[model samples]
Target: MLLACSGVLAAPTSVSAVSADGGSRITQVKVYPGSATVERTARVPAGARSLTIRCLSPQLDVQSLQVQADAHVRIGESSVKVQDRDLDKECATPLDDQVRDAEDRVASAKAETDSLELATSYLRTVATVPPSEPHSGPGTPGSASINGTTDTLRRSSQDLLLKLHQSKRRQEAAELALKELTEERNRIAGPKARTSTVTITLASDREGELRLSYQLRGPGWSPSYRAALDSTSGVVKFERLALVAQNTGEDWRNVQLALSTGQPTRSTAGRLPGPWTINVAPAEQFTTEIRAMPAPAPVAASKVTLMSMGDRGAETTPAMPNFDVQVSDDAYATEFTVPQRITVPSGGQRITLSLGSLDARAQLVSRTSPGVEPAAYLIAQLSALPGVWPAAPVALYRDGAYVGQGRLDNNSDELSRTGLSFGRDERVVVTAEPQQQNSGSAGFTGANVERKVQHAYRVESRHQRPIALQVLDAAPVSQNEQIDVVSQYDPLPADKAWNRRPGLILWSETLAPGSSLRFTAAHTLRYPKDARLQESK
Candidate 1:
């Protein structure tokens, strides 16, 4: 008697599943801008890492799913918004489902091929065996009949072999099915591992408030959030959480927590803030936290003055150019003039050109009448006063060259003997000296200026990999003049100067113009990423 075939008799199928069944059934869900949801049950095996449920109805479109450990939830029905009919054409089908289906088909085809091979081999061996004979040869009665039976058995065996060969040909057709399935799977699964993304964009506000927001998406699902508010004034401050969560689950539960509103730390809101921190936590696990409100920057106010003009002693009818000098926080000053054509033509005059207050801190610049464009001049009184020193060293750098310190000519004996001056069209920069005062100053520093002036050469390297470069000196060194070396790009404070010392090593007492000073700075050039997983350009 033949046994009836059951569904189980067809083939052995293994189902991989996700964990935890949901108490909620996501039915009739709609996303405002071209999004959809679908629900369906999946038969998943126990202790599986993940399980994807399929949508039964073609009318339903699924954008994403939320699966917890140990649960296989399916799409019941989906409500999708078709904003543009064009989008519907492109986003009409669920690509992920296609990929999964393709993978399954490929596996099934491989299994079929193996089974067919076995059957073909067994049939070939059977055909080669001679059929058993139940005949008494020679004088035995009905021996002729026994020979005929043998012949019939042999023909049947040959037919069976032919059928086995046909089955093998059928397996070849199955390969095409496998290939199609694989292509579909690839189309669905975009080539990258999913990760939670948090973007801290600085929003524009006249009040100088810091606004932050977050958005997240994953397999079978999508979610978004936004938070905005002003931070307090100081080196650092904290603010309240302000985030809104949206659920995009069909049959599974969707939960979200505002971990930290503005976490400035490497760890979660719970961790301490550091100089370097890159990652943020999931939005669902923590409350919105805003910390360390940065302080507002100070405005720079500077002033310049002409302290003295030598005694204008001359004939009663001496002549001078129209002198206009005005002094104020504004660029205002006063002017005076002596009648033209009168000259004493005697000893050099000592002019006391007082332009600034001794106690006030401000920048000073000047211009003289007759426009002779003095070859060199110095501020003697200003140099003597220590309070007037700029935050950074100020030098008369003209035409890519430094002025000699020996040329400083200061006549004022009040403050100090030191003085500063400039030639025609030359800039006398009273710059704040470059120094890592607090190790956290954001403004221009000495090291920063040095780095900018230093030459940079590109070195090719592998992406995301560390690279190192050796420093070498190629030029003679100097003493009166100074040279500093530095590297930019995730550089540490210690790396500011290599070997716990400055990068510079003096080649001589002075490095004149055209002298070459060389040092190597190593950096890795990142390679382009794999196109499949990257955001579409």
Candidate 2:
């Protein structure tokens, strides 16, 4: 972050010539989910004529570049130009010391390998000396002495070979380590590290600070939440975090980072409805016709119309969703200022930053739809969330143990409270009896069919304390006048439309320890025998 405030130029005369400067650094960054804005400031002495901020990444939106200075300093518009050479050496990752250490390790390993290889070669050379007319003395323990010497030489050769083999392996490993580190460092300083220099004409009567900021499309951050529930306290500890990353060929070192909910990269205006006009139509009729055109034109470059890439239609592939919940978040804009400075390395590597934490009022309830799932799920009904929270996946923990993942559905402008679901609770058992169905033809010579279905469910609580439980089920609704459906329950449900879901009924009560309850629903339908019904997911 040498760009934050790394330079101070000596006072120059009004006629001072323009020159590039490196004494500036990224001071602050406001990162949205898809784009980021970077601000750099530098100190300038009185009489300074112009300031040129050099080695800025080319990924920034040049049209968004702006220059601001003290009112005492008059400044002209800033212009950006692509630099002809490589990026500034300072723009690379701040891992030079690490890269050097890796290189040293490689060199040391190579040296050890070479030493071992030299010793092995020398051993081979000496082992071939050829006995040299051994003494020729009478009975000098002839054959035994020769065998002993051979054994010694063989043992020495084996040891040296082993040492050489191990040394080579170490050398290879060291080389690989060096390669990885070097590649990581170069990845941030590679060919895509093209840069641009922004020069802003200025005339200052006194010392002041020159600030330059621009919007970039590379860096982004997304909200991630952690919710931990303490059943005894009936409170959920909700923590906010952000996954931040960048690939702008520059490292963000301890910069003031702010996460904003505003979407500057999206369309600024709301979409207008196309049309709802209705028109009278003619009677349907089939018609066929054939039209032919001349399509033989070759070698006519002069008559060709030149068009840019923008003129061509582009096929954009839709992004794959992280979850099955297809929800559009249109909440009011909000911002979270990270309490501490953050650092995220370049190369799309993410680092999680903590935003803040708050406790939310929560109630734990066991709920189940026996027809859909035969087990009751533990749900945390939450209220009083932060002013605005975008829909995001939440990591759940109960009593310090990870429960599972949950979804936060408070992303709508009109919605406030959101419910979080934990995995099923086996302690609260649910049983759905077989559905009883009967059908028969009725109404004047079998003109219509009558069908009746009866569903029964039983729930039991094994908890030592009383717990609130909700049971839900949906009754069939007829869409056509020819079909008449009537639903009846053994005991009227507490809510006919549970959570605003039509046709879904809810049953609620505080179940005592080891207590059980039973409920039943019956539906009768009468419809034309030839009519068919379609099932929907």
Candidate 3:
């Protein structure tokens, strides 16, 4: 007995165990368009000759892993690989124990229900049994005794029935509790049981720190904007925000978060030029094919011009929480390092972060295109910033009320103004009549055909406050040398050159309350009767 006891207590020989190294904790995260970079740090023990650090996540990009350490620590070989891990190992929490307890209670409740059902059935049979003899004359001792027994049996049956009903209700409550607990457990523990592991080996002479950085593919951020314009104050309040999302299978808790406009997944190197080859086609065959093809569609010569007119304006907003972000700007990219630590859970949920706000100078202008839309649109002209402004979705607001949503065009490396259109301004009224055209022969032999058209527009401002108004109109452009096109404007337009769009005329004026304005445009064209004028594209 003594020998057996000693043998049981002795340690086993050739015991094999695989121990994982202490992993590092994430400290910094930089999110990009479709990927993110994670940085972690770990402390090495003093005088440790060898140390290992494990970094694990489900969306880790193994190829982009990098490591660094202090002077006293030297990084050795590192490896990254995907492995299957028990979901319970990482996801199990106190909720699991609670779920088990609830399941046990359900089983207990069902057992009690079964026992109560049996007792109720026995009581029912006893209550149903008829008296042995027929009822004697009333007030007889036999009748009185029988009545007492029957009353006692009926009361007992009712009590059993009530207990049975309570037992069923308890069972139902237990079942409901079990179902809720099960769902909670499933939610806490995700659907997958696999993750990735990154292992790094190092040698250190004294206590030091190790840093690991790697790219992940499952985290990203997008830009959103809010612009509020107060026409009365002539101020525009612009707020830039970011919507960040991540599901890297690892919660980023208390980690420094940074957002960048750069796209890491896109090619970084300059594009390589391919060989330019020219092949001479068979002239006859090409000509034949071209002739057989259908004639190209004719395009209209009408032109519509959109112009912005405004200066900067004051900004107004609620006081913003301090986010001491260090902004770094370069020709290639811009980065903002958030000062505060952020927490993002490991699910595809978005968290909004305030990037910053701008109080750009702006001006309100009412624009009308009577030929297209009779209603006048209230527009705000905002001066462009020096840096790159990536295209994003913007929500427009006017006078503390939401107007509509618009898209911000990409204006990187360009010095230009941005225009935001609020809903139609009912204070301004506009009307346009249909244009009239006449064609007739002209010149000596009647070889030339002349065309003339007239356009007329009327606008009125009914606003209590004075407003700046712009009316846009256009005329046909001549594309053929033989076609001579001339335009005449009543009360010459402010800018006839129409810098970007030819044949477009703009009229700018300041209108007082309850004022009206009218304008007209006349165009004439002359060309050979046999030749058709080509339309301007």
lDDT of each: 0.27, 0.70, 0.69
Q: What is the lDDT ranking, best to worst?
A: 2, 3, 1
Residue by residue across 288-374, what tens digits does model 1's lDDT show? 454664554442221111111222443475345432322222232111221121111101111122112222121222211111222
**Model 2 compared with the native: what TM-score?**
0.76
Positional deviation of 168 in candidate 3, in angstroms?
Answer: 9.0
Residues 1-537 of candidate 3: C-alpha lDDT, one tens digit per residue: 000000001112244222223436778889887788988887766544444432266567878988888987887777665655453243334555777899899999999889988887756544454556554554323323445665787787788788889989999999999888776544433444345655555555566787888898757887778888888887877777777876565667667788888878766665454565556668655632222334544432211111011111215542443575577898878997776667765555567777777776677889888987898999887667545556788899999999999876547412122277878999999989788989999999999999998989989999998898888887787766888988998868997645467777888889999999888999999999999666642
The candidate that achieves the highest TM-score relative to the unseen native structure: 2
Off by over 4 Å in 2: 1-22, 83-163, 166-170, 186-192, 273-332, 384-386, 411-418
Task: Compare candidates 2 and 3 on lDDT and give the better one.
Answer: 2
- lDDT assessment of candidate 2: 0.70
Q: Is candidate 1 or candidate 3 better by TM-score?
A: 3
Backbone Cα, N, C clashes tallied per candidate: 74, 7, 5
TM-score of 1: 0.20
TM-score of model 3 (CA atoms):
0.73
